[model samples]
Target: MRDLDALDRRLIELLSREPRIGVLECSRRLGVARGTVQARLDRLQARGVIRGFGPDIDPAALGYTVTAFATLEIRQGRGRDVRAHLARIPEVLEMHTITGAGDMLCRIVARSNSDLQRVIDRVVDFDGIVRTSTVIALENPIPYRVLPLVTQDGKGLATPRDAARPQGEG
Candidate 1:
């Protein structure tokens, strides 16, 4: 993995705060040269550090209020087949082959509880899947974030508090 320095973190922080900002704007905000910002962005993308500037959509805003995680137990040697089956379902937001009691854990969203049941049924309809357990999320007290990870510089990791602090402060 490539390590990120303070400059990289600052550049990412600036772009993340204002995704609409262009390379010239980023250079201004970060107080760096335009070509430097462009080059860094290009390098970040080439190294798979920065994936894309895609819009972040909220499922609740899209009328899919119900969020649930389904743990699936599938027949041995059929993990790949079960994954391909789940990939076809639009409601399956994310899927991972996990350890412990379940072979796979899938994050799904639905319109309602009844609709969630329908989605679950579709997941279980696969021939390789033997069992499944699902738990619905009532509320998200803390949503997902990557800024904390971005705060890290060199060998040190930054805490959430550190991210809130001004840059260059120990």
Candidate 2:
């Protein structure tokens, strides 16, 4: 957080809500100068305090009715290659290399169970993917939400990029 003051916290909260908000508008809302907002944003981004943000799309609205997570075990010496392979699959919305039983975890969406099967089977057929286990989600209790950087104690969990947690948001 680089000892972020209240103004910096306000800026991050505002940016998380709307990344494209103009600096002038942000300044007006925070009662700070546009240049000050710009400087804070630049520092935040440079120090990895704030990444990027965009819209959150609904899979159901997009006709993807099925959501699944696939746990994949890679062949020897092929973990990195397996991720690249899974990334090429259109259905794989998110991929993570977890520390649990699986080497890679993939989130996929499909229009139907058969479609989901096809997607997972494609991943299973990949060269480096040795085995796979899948958990088809019946419902998503919470979709996706970002973390609150500023804590209750008026402090932010300032972690470097390497220390940030994974997206195992179940």
TM-score of 1: 0.91
CA displacement after TM-score superposition, residue 13 of candidate 1 (Å): 0.9
Q: lDDT, candidate 2, residue 50? A: 72
Largest TM-score belongs to which candidate? 1
lDDT of all predictions: 0.87, 0.77
Which runs in model 1 stand beyond 4 Å of their true positions?
154-170
In model 1, the number of clashes is 0
TM-scores, each model vs. reference: 0.91, 0.80
Alpha carbon lDDT at 130, candidate 1: 97
Q: What is the lDDT of residue 117 in candidate 1?
A: 97
The sequence of per-residue lDDT tens digits that candidate 2 reaches over residues 92-161 is: 8999888889888888999999988788788898789878899999987766754444422244443443
